[model samples]
Target: MSHTFRRRFAALVLALSLLTLPARALTAQEAGQLLQDYYIDDVSQEVLAQPTIDAMLSALGDHYTTYFTADEYAAFLASMEDVQLTGIGVKMQASENGPVVVEVLAGSPALEAGLQAGDLITAVDGVSTAGLEMGAVSALIQGQEGTQVTITYLRDGVSAACTLTRSSILVAATSAQLLEDHVGLLTCTTFGHDTYAHFTEALDQFPQADRWIVDLRDNGGGLTQAALDTLSVFTGGGIKCYFMDGSAQLSALEAKREQISSAPLIVLTDGGTASASEIFSAGIRDLKAGLVIGGRTYGKGVAQSVLDQYTNPELFDGDAMKITTVRFYTASGSTTDTVGVIPHLLVSPDLAQEVALLLSAAPPSGGTAGYYRLDLNGSWYISQKAALAQPEVFAQLLAAIPPTAALWQGSGDGWNSVQPQQAAADHSIPFQSRLFSDVEGSPYAQSIQRLAVYGVVLGNGQGSYFPKSSLTRAQLAALLAQALNCTVPTGESLFSDVSMDDSYGLAINAIAKMGLVEGVGNGLFRPDDTVTHEQFFTIMGRLAQRVSLTFQISRQGATQEDLDSDRLSRFAPWSRLSVWLLSSSQLDELDQPVSLLWDDVTRIDPTAPISREEAADLLCAVLERTGILPA
Candidate 1:
């Protein structure tokens, strides 16, 4: 008989033998025989696939363990290497007290679900975790995508139940915001694939900001390539990082010449920062691109390469191996392995004092009515203020608006002229008039008018401005760039597939220039894709950095009280952005709550193209309220 036939016969006999054995009497060998009988065949490929099987067997502990063919192995590797993973975005610390949320990535599932740092894990999935090890708690929380897990936690002596859905949580290594006084703040959570893109987007969103704060506190680490990419944003060119495998030194990663922003930068870090985070922080610090703040970082400088076991399941069982093969060194040739990168300034955590500090500085003791402070230069506020300040400026701003709109209208024609207003006997203006009219008397009217006048929304060349078109990713970027008066250099498109004629081309280019968006595999910017609420919040946070930067600049020469009151609180994400932008913002001070107009909220058809009008109105409203635009 042929070898294949013999192997098949052996597998069949083994299966028959297992069927005859009593289930209760089965030994480990018997169970192995049963699995082998039903699952394996002795092909050459299968022989080579044994190591993977061994790894999987070793890794399994009562959970599901299945063998993967070569093709299956490749697919599994892809999923593991994916920048996003299914889990809540949080890092746990095993302390004498309990499992505490040490860090929470911005705009993550955990952050959205209202989880916070200092929150103690009391129970997970209904099991009491009173004395559970941090590793156990982490294992309980991590699971397959789409799975739901319940977590019970204590915050300030109050217990709360949070149900979170597991989705691919992309660890945002970098986030940028334009503060109130044109100061930019970029927060690096940990280095990851999307770090550079997101960082650049933040910078592009507020290119003109005078100063910046790059927050790297508690950023553990990931992907060396991502760390280098982030450093490239600040450095001019060449050798961001190098790898050392023992005494063997490899070529260094060189920075590309694409400079995003050169604003004076301040980086925040703590003892929890490690590995790639150290690489980025140290690089920028060494280059004098930014000043480090907070405490020292967690020193982890080893480079690990993942070896997936899919084809040869028997050799590795079924689990993958991540072997540390290299050690990373800074540009200054310092090893950040055990000796962490220390910050330039040391700001310890003071929850009560910080809250009091922010509250006391709260904008001029305004009325309790929800009021948004405007920063005059931000895209949203700039458009709104310019329309309110000079109606003619609105006309000028409208004139420069790009022709990327899906629908267009002839120049010099007002929207009202094209779409006749239905006579409204009630005090409420007709929807069409409300959308297109540039009359600036009422604040509400001014808010509505500024959005229209900014060319964020145009009348269907036929005169009807559809204020309710579902916002798409492309449309939002375009509107934001227009409002900010952002300039996109004419260069070869970074995306391999996006054409100049594509509607999203300019917006994609602008976002890429600012560093808010990145192309997916092989340089493809999926421009027309609809953005989710989380994605939108991430972008808004980036824009909000400018407002924070502005506050920092305004208080540059001020006293500690002035700095604490005006500078910190004004741009404080805890005080301003999160609280003002997200509903969850009400839960914590950092939860910058955003209140949207009823119409605006309804118009966010999450799956459709976000009309230019919606983007314009939302950006304008946010900027106006944040005090980034002059009220």
Candidate 2:
């Protein structure tokens, strides 16, 4: 036979063998019976099956959707509940100048590593990112916490290398301040699980304030329950708010608790405050809780209930759609749906400086001014003063509010575990030679091990846990996903270069959805990219946002100082994220960056990819600092 004819014969035989195997594998009788049972009885079955099969096959033509399955559905739910994932902290868009950083979160590893707004990311790691789509480039930059990623980019005319350690990046939700004047300022980013708690905590400390200012600007809403809980504080046994289900009226808020405070209240709102934030604001305004301030609020009075099955069992998980089931109404039966609550005191961002002018003409005792000084003893001392005679200086001082609370002197001393070196000497244990034995007996070991067991750390990839390798972007993202028990997406690759088989593909997709990172261009995703120190800080900042959104405490009247500043630092980008979260209110103090203590970098290697060892150490450190890990 000719060679071509022989090859064709072999190919035919292979095709026949492939087709024949399935029948043999399933027993011909059983296969035939099953087919007959489902399809042979009716012509409709045969016709419908063909169309259904055709539709399924056509859907698979787009690789992105081909991978969807029952498992994928669960994974999608997990992503939404957590609301965010890990990656480098930078907002990117296809601008006229090409992909540009729109905003850089303050105190993120990105900022620490020297990546700035307007700096063009030309490459990720060593791969040229040219022509790659934004999402693909973002995938390259995100990863497990503590893993290192390298970024090569151009700033001005200079080429530079920045290594960033990805950490769990969270979007912030609530920010509060006891303004120098006795007015309490609170900003809610979103109405998530913890928002009410955060607000309560802020309020509890400032019960004596004369007036309160609630800032809900730029707050895109979240959980309905959160909004109800927030509104409950200011309302008496009155109709808190109502929801309209189609044409029927549904009472969403039946007064659960008696009103906590009825002090003169002022709510600041803007275009960014929508959904649950609007509901809460409108409830207060209608119930006579406070005065509404600032620009017009975003009109998102519709309520949505999300059912997600993939989230942690402790969270709301089920197959649920966030459909607009109800339209929110104020206590007075007025609809603030598309037409949001107009502020009783309309203060525009541009006119914010005129607050002094507005105040000067008002009553003098209505507002008070003060400065906070942290004593070496950990006690915060408030120095009362009259409102500043100079308007510009007062605004500058307010603008300089520390992004995070000052380190409490008592915190380090109270929670400090004996240093390993000191503990060894004090206990008469040998230091280096008996390291493992010492660790076994050390009280701090349990806390460290807990973090490790939680998948927050996996030692170094090698058998030895280096404990000091700098964290990289990829490593941090992985650890964060693990810590949150985030469901990562899997299937055909979304980027041109990233294969479906790549191990980190799911995580990359999760982070991309969270808006923590962005791509360079084209369809490439350089997963092996290293990150810079500044980028690491930005990732922490993003994590802070998630933390704030997920966890919140309520406070009564507004005060001049934040009580939870130290807690916010673990999520480093709290300052900027706080702004986005609380864009509605008059509290502008949180929009500024806070200064980090000089020694904050000792635990992190600023130049290298944050390694697994570093991630473990940092996780332990945070847990310890937060008192989650016992001393």
Alpha-carbon lDDT of model 2: 0.48
Candidate with top lDDT is: 1
* lDDT (C-alpha) at residue 116 in model 1: 86
- lDDT against the true structure, per candidate, is 0.51, 0.48
Using Cα atoms with residue i matched to residue i, what is each candidate's TM-score against the true structure?
0.35, 0.37
lDDT of 2 by residue, 183-235 (tens): 66666767766776777777787765655667677777666666777788776
Report RMSD (Å) for each prediction in the order shown.
Answer: 28.0, 29.3
Clashes of 1: 86
After superposition, candidate 2 runs with Cα above 4 Å error? 1-84, 87-141, 149-164, 170-172, 175-186, 204-213, 246-252, 258-266, 304-318, 347-631
**Candidate 1 lDDT, 1-631, residue by residue in tens:** 1333223322111001112322222123433433333222222333333344454344332112343333454454443233566788887778677898967766677888999879988898899887887778878998999899998999999999999987777754455555555666666665655677787777667767766666666667766777777787777677876665433434465667566666555566776777778888778766666555455567665665433323222433333333344566667555565445644332342121121111111232323222112221121112222223333323322322221211111122221111212112121232323245332333344444544433333444444444545566666667566545454557677787777677667767877776655666777777777765445644665554433322223223334453244323433333233323332222124655345432533333333344444455556655544332222
Top candidate when judged by TM-score against the true structure: 2
